[model samples]
Target: SMGNQILGGGGFGTRLMSEVREKRGLSYGVYSGFTPMQARGPFMINLQTRAEMSEGTLKLVQDVLADYLKTGPTEKELDDAKRELSGSFPLSTASNADIVGQLGAIGFYNLPLSHLEDFMQQSQNLTVEQVRAALNKHLSTDKMVIVSAGPTVPQKPLPAPTDKPAEQPLGV
Candidate 1:
C-alpha cells in the first residue's frame, strides 16, 4: 500500500508539471513528493506560478491523480523509475549524515546491520508491477489533506468528491 501510494503520487506530480505547466504554460516548475512514515505522513505539491493560475494548477493536480489511479505506469515508465532510483541511491548514501541516519534507522527499527547492504539489491529487484501494486494500495487522493500558506492564495473550490475517507484505522 505504501509503495502504491508513493509511485502513484510521485507519478501524478510529474505528470501534472509536464502537462499543466510545461506544455500548457499554466505554471512554472511544479513538483510533488510524498513522505510515508512509520505511521502517517504527507504528500505535497509545490508549484510556482502567478496568482491567476492557482485554481487551474490545483485542478490539474486532481485530474492527474484521478487519471493515474485509473491507469498506472507503463513498463517503460516503471523501468525508468527503477533506473533513476538505483542510480541515485549511491549519491544519497554518499554523505556522512546519510550513513549515520541510516544506521540510526536500523537501530531504531531493530533491523540488522545488513539492512543497509541489502537495500540496493532489494530496490533493484523491485519490478514495475510491484511498484504499481504498491501505489494502488497506498495512494488515496481522497484521504489527502490540503494546506496552503501565502498571499494571493486562490479561493478556488477544493476538488470535488470532498468527503475525507477514513484512514486505515491505525492500530497498535
Candidate 2:
C-alpha cells in the first residue's frame, strides 16, 4: 500500500498519482514507505500542490487514506504490490554497496543472519488479508501526524478541463 502511494505498481504508474494528480489535479506527487526496524518504524505519505489547492489536496489525501485503511487492499492491489517489490528486489541486492547496506542494517539491528532470505520468503507467502491486516494495524489515519505549510485560499472546485484530446500528435 505504501509502495503504491510512492511509486505505484512496479513504478510504471501509481494509484495515488492517478487519484490525486491525474484525476483530481491535486498535487504533483505523493509518496509512502515502510522501512524495517527493530520494532516499528515509519510509514509516511506526503504531497504538494499549489498554495490555493493545499487544503483541498490535504482533504483528498485524508480521504484516500481513510478509504485505504477502511477497506484495506483488493487482491489485485495486493498482488501488484508484491510483484513490484519482488521484481525490483534484485536491484536492492545488485551491488556491493547494496550488500553492504543490507549487512550493515542486519548487524546494526542484530537481525537474524537470514533476514534477507526470510524477508523474501515471508513476502512471497503473504496473503491480501495478511497485508491488509498488518497495514491496518500499523498504518492508521487516526495515528497519523500531518504538518502543512501553505497560503490560505478559499476552497474552490477544480476547473473542468475544457480542451479536447487531439486526434493525433504532430509527429505521429
Residues 140-162, candidate 1, lDDT per residue (tens digit)? 77887766555675454322221
Lowest lDDT 10-residue stretch of candidate 2: 163-172
Q: lDDT score of model 2?
A: 0.65
Clashes of each: 6, 0
Best by TM-score: 2
Candidate 2 local lDDT, residue 147: 87
Tell me the spans in candidate 2 whose CA falls farther than 4 Å from its real position. 1-12, 35-39, 158-172
**lDDT (Cα atoms) of all candidates against the true structure:** 0.60, 0.65
Residue 108 Cα positional deviation in candidate 1, in Å, after optimal superposition = 3.3
After superposition, which runs of candidate 1 have C-alpha atoms over 4 Å from their true positions? 1-13, 149-172
